[model samples]
Target: MKFYTFAKSVAYSILKPLYRIEAIGTENFPKEGGVLLCSNHINNFDPPVVGIMIPRTVYFMAKEELFAVPILGDIIRRCNAFPVKRGMSDRDALRKGLSVLKDGHILGIFPEGTRSKTGELGKGLAGVGFFALRSNAQVVPCAVIGPYKAFRKLKVVYGKPMQMDELRKAKASPEEVTDLIMAEIQKLITEYR
Candidate 1:
C-alpha cells in the first residue's frame, strides 16, 4: 500500500476505537477526478480525521511553520501536505494547490483559515472560493462534529457537491462565491447537530 494509505489505516485503527468515528453521506464524495473537500477546523486532528474518512488521498495545506518541525514535518510532507504561509496571500501555496487539482487529485481545505476556538463555524477566507472557481472543481462540504474529546463519538457528514454552474456562468465575485460555500458548510454543520 502507499504510505498515506498505510498511515491512514494505522490512524483509523487507533482513532476509531477511541473516538468511535462515524461517517455519514460518504457516498457524496466523488469517486474520482479533482475535488475540493471543504470543512470546518476545530483542532490539529481535523485534517487527518477528515482525510481518513474520505476514500481518496487528500492533499491538504498546512502552515509553513509545521513543515519546519523535526520528524513531524517529514511525516506530513510524506502524507501530501504542502505548506502555506498563514496571514498572507502566499501565491506559491496557491499555485501548488491549483497544481494538485490540475493533476486530478483531491485538495482538502479548511475554509475558515484556522481552527475555531469555540468549535463554532466562522467566516471563510476568500482563497478557498478562488481556488474552487479557478480550478473548476466540484466542492464537497463536510461537517465534523465532536472529536473534541477522546472516548467520545466523532461524527463526520459529507454534503452533496455544491452546484457551481450558475455561479460560474454568472461570473460571480469571489466574495459571493465564498459566502455561498460558507452557507453550504453551515447547513452541513446544522445537519450534524
Candidate 2:
C-alpha cells in the first residue's frame, strides 16, 4: 500500500480504540472527480479523524506551523498534507489547493481556518468559498463531533454535496458561498448531536 494509505490505516486503528469513531452519510461522498471536503475544526485530531473515514485519500490543507515540527511534520507531509499560512491570503497555498482539485483529488479544508477552543463552530474563512468558486469542485460539508476528547464517541457526519452550478454562474461572492457551506456544516453538527 502507499504510505498515505498505510499511515491512515495505522492511525485509524489506534484512534478507533481511543475514540468511538463513527461515520454518517458517507454515501454523500462523490465516487470520483475533484472534491473539496470542508469541515469544522475542533482540534488537531479533526483532520485525521475525518480524513481516515473518507474512502478517498484526502490532500489536507494544514496550517503551516504544523510543518515546522520535526517528526510530526514529516508524518503529515508523507500522509499527503500541505501547508497553508493562517491569517492572510496565502496565494501559494491557494494555488496548491486548486492544483489538488484540478488533479481530480480530494482536498480537505477547515473553513474556520483554526481550531475553536470552545468547541463552538466559528465563522468560516472566505478561502474555502474562494476555492469552491474557483475550482467548481463538489463541496462536501462534514462535521467532526467530539474530537477534542479521547474515549468519547467521535462522529464525522457528512452532508449532501452542495452543487455550485447556479452559484458559480451568478459569480457568487466568496463570503456568500462560505456562509452557505458553514450553514450546512452546522446543520450536520446539529443533527449528529
Candidate 3:
C-alpha cells in the first residue's frame, strides 16, 4: 500500500539473488523518526542495496548521471531518489532531502559521493554531516563491505548511532563533520572487509 513497500518488494525481488548479501545491525535502526544513514560508497548499486534491505523507506541522494539511464532512472524515481550534483551543492536536492527528513523518513547518504574505483575509501562529502546537524536527526553509521556479488556474500554492518553533538560544536566546519563520519564509516568497513 505504501510507496516504500512496493519499492522494497520490487527491489528485493530483483536484486537479492543478483548479489549475495550478509547484513547485520539492521536492528540498530530506530523504529521511528528522522535518521541519517551514513555509509561508505564502494559499488554503484550500494544505494539500492542499503535502501531496499531496510523495511523503512530510505531515500538517497542519487548522482545525477544515474538518472540519465532510461530504465534505471524510472526505477530510481519510483524509489524516491532525488538527483544531486556531485561537485556543486544542488539547493533543490538539499531542499528535497530536508523535506524527506522533515517527513521523518530515513535519509541514506554515501558520504563519498562517487564509487571508489580503487576500492580505497576516500574522504566524505559534507552533505550528510550538515544535513544531520540541520535536521537534528540521529546519524546511523553503516558500512557495506565489498564486492557486491553473489559469491562474495557482501556484508552490510550498521553500528550504533553516532552522537549528533559530535558535529554540534561551535567551531565545527562542514568538512570536519564530513571527516568524522567518513573515518567512522571507513573504520567499520575496514573491519568488515
Candidate 4:
C-alpha cells in the first residue's frame, strides 16, 4: 500500500505534464468508497497509463503470463496487480477483484476483454454487468484516446459514473443490463477515438 501510494503520486505528477492529461467528468467519481472503473483497452501500456494517471490506486486484472517474468512480476504484484487466466472466464480473478471493491478499493476491468488491435471499438463482455449488479458499486466509465506512438502523447478520458439508481429502477433483465453497460462503455470510448 505504501509503495502504491508513493508510486501513484509520482506517476500522476510526471504523467499529467508529460501526457498533457485531462480527466473529463471526474466528478462522477465518488470521492470516497469503492468503484469499478471499466475502460477500453487499446495498448499494452494502457494499464500503467491509466494506473499511474488516476489519483487513486486501481487494482488491475492483468494476464497471468505477465506474472511469470521473474522480478518484473514481483514489482507488478506489489503495485496491486492480480493475474487473470487469459481467454477464459477467470472466475478466481473476478472474485478477487470483487473482493477488493467489497473492501472499498477501486478495481479496474477492461470489459471488452481484450485490447483494440483494429482501432475500432468492440462490445463489452457480460462480466461487467454481472459484477455491477452483484456489488452495487458505482461504475466509472473511461476511455483512452490515441496510442503510445513514438514521440506522441496519449490521453485518458474519464466519463461520469453510471447511475446505479437508474439501473436498479430499470428492472432490466440480465441481457438488458449487460447491453446497457456495454452501451455506456462504448459511449465512453467513442469520444476518445
Best lDDT goes to which candidate? Answer: 2
List the global CA lDDT of all models. 0.89, 0.91, 0.81, 0.77
TM-score of each: 0.97, 0.96, 0.91, 0.86
Comparing candidate 2 with candidate 4, which one achieves the higher TM-score? 2
Q: Can you write out model 1's per-residue Cα lDDT over 74-123, one digit (the tens) per residue?
A: 99999999999999999999999999988889999998989998999999
TM-score of 4: 0.86
Q: Residue by residue across 1-193, what tens digits does model 2's lDDT show?
A: 2999899999899887789898899999998999999999987788888888878899999889989999999999999899998888899999999999999999999999988889989999999999999996899999988754668888889889999989999989999999999999999888887
Residue 159, model 3: Cα distance from true site in angstroms: 1.4
Candidate 1 lDDT for residue 156 = 86
Question: In candidate 2, how many Å is residue 65 off?
Answer: 1.2
Q: Write the per-residue lDDT of candidate 3 for residues 78-193, one digit (tens) a residue.
A: 77888998899789999888888888988898887888888788878878767877887788888888676665677788888787775586657778777877888888877878
Task: Report the C-alpha displacement of residue 27, candidate 1, in angstroms.
Answer: 0.6
Instruction: Give the Å error, residue 54, model 1.
Output: 1.6
Q: What is the alpha-carbon lDDT of model 4 when measured against the actual structure?
A: 0.77
Better of 2 and 4 by lDDT: 2
Q: How far is candidate 3 from the true structure (C-alpha RMSD, Å)?
A: 1.8
